[model samples]
Target: MIIDITCRTDRFNLSAVGPHFINDCCFGEDFSRWLVGALRRTGVDASVIGMEDFGWSNQATLDGTTYLVCVAGNSDALADNPDRGEWHVMLERKRSLMQRLTGEGKTSATDPLVRRIARVLMEAGLVEVGVEA
Candidate 1:
């Protein structure tokens, strides 16, 4: 079945897209949901980086479709190999740097306390970080 993903361009512009995505991914077929969840706070920053790296703009349009340009790692690429420590570490470093530069502290779409609580649940076997691979 096709997902109901839409080009909610305005939400991304307001830095809300990342937050919105965290929950949508939890139950999706691609079981490596944490990859997307981990990125909840950094998506906006990635978008800005895209502006420099790919000459992507903070704003863009194609064939009358407008979009807020955000750098979400490719789902297809990630789904193939989900748990590489190197990628996690690299992304964390980038996220740290971006936070300092932007002066916009990172808060997961969920609060930090909530994330910790959920982590505990997953660790205790009440939940699982499902592996799509």
Candidate 2:
């Protein structure tokens, strides 16, 4: 299976650090590194696909994978795998449950995690960043 991990690539998509998941991470830089490492651990090949004003997409190429996993500014993980693999299932499941449940009992979370991840990717020398807000 394959998954896409997207995040807000916007250099000015910032808001108050609410008491939600959005407040936890905000496109810092550590998140992205974690992502790359996570995928690496799972034997997945992930590539950054640049960003728009406030969005970016990641390509997770797993074992013979050819699908997508898209995350957004305030979005979750999107895994598309024709042949669901065990590794993919576990990896995705962990992320889904952690992210969704972590922000429980709260309004919409403009998930800073994704953005923070983008920042991390930039610093890790994996993704080249133009500007940050």
Candidate 3:
């Protein structure tokens, strides 16, 4: 299965604080390390994708399946707006083997693996939304 994960934070803006604060925040170095570790524990080979305009991500693969886990600050401002808080996290599974086996259909957030990943993110205090099929 291919998992595409997007974590949106509430009132958090990594870009405004600059890279220096990355290691000092929850959605920073610690989160990245923790996520990669979690994936590894699940028997998935994972690696960091480094920083992005808003946050960062990690990539993983298991049984020839790919997983892209991303966390970013959401805002509509042309520039980084730490003041514009985020409200949700979105996770979608793409090119999934499960979908193929079950035939093309609506995405189900109740999938075991999806739940597992959601649990992991929740453990970090994120509010999950739009994860349901």
Candidate 4:
């Protein structure tokens, strides 16, 4: 199955930090790096893509299965101003039996790394989609 994990940020001041600074120096870079490393440790191939406006995507492959992870902000907000927006962390699983049965699908939530990531995002004040805050 293909899993997509997306992380969205709460509204913040991008003007003070700048998109590049935030992307590289703040949460975005660290989270993406940690995620990729954690997945690799699990024997999965993973990578980060499109690092701009503190929004990016990650790709992972394991056991012939592919997953896409994304960390982005609302398009309208990003287009207008980097700040004054919320971030989204979307986890999407493709072609999975769970998805076939449930429209939303499932992920490696049981995995320690996955859970840790979720918790960290939550601590950072980001909400998980489909999950009660």
CA-RMSD of model 4: 7.7
When 3 and 4 are scored with TM-score, the better candidate is 3
Please report how far candidate 1 places residue 87 from its true position, in Å: 16
* Residue pairs with clashing backbones, model 3: none
**Candidate 3 residue-wise lDDT, 1-133, digit = tens:** 3334445553444444554544433344445666678767877687787765446666766556465666544454435455444433233345667867877633355555566666666666765433533
| Candidate topping TM-score | 3
Q: What's the TM-score of every candidate structure?
A: 0.16, 0.32, 0.50, 0.43
Ranking by TM-score: 3, 4, 2, 1
Candidate 2 vs candidate 3: the TM-score winner is: 3
> Candidate 1's C-alpha lDDT?
0.26
Show the lowest summed lDDT stretch of 10 residues, model 1.
Answer: 1-10
For candidate 2, write residues 63-130 as lDDT tens digits: 44222333333422324322111111101212345646676322111233333334554554542332
Order of the predicted models by lDDT, top scorer first: 3, 4, 2, 1
Task: Provide the lDDT at 5 for model 3.
Answer: 47
In terms of lDDT, the poorest run of 10 residues in model 3 is 83-92
lDDT string for model 4 (26-54, tens) is 33444566667766765767887646554
In the range 58-88, model 1's lDDT, one tens digit per residue, is: 3322233223322222122234344211111
Best-fitting candidate, measured by lDDT?
Answer: 3
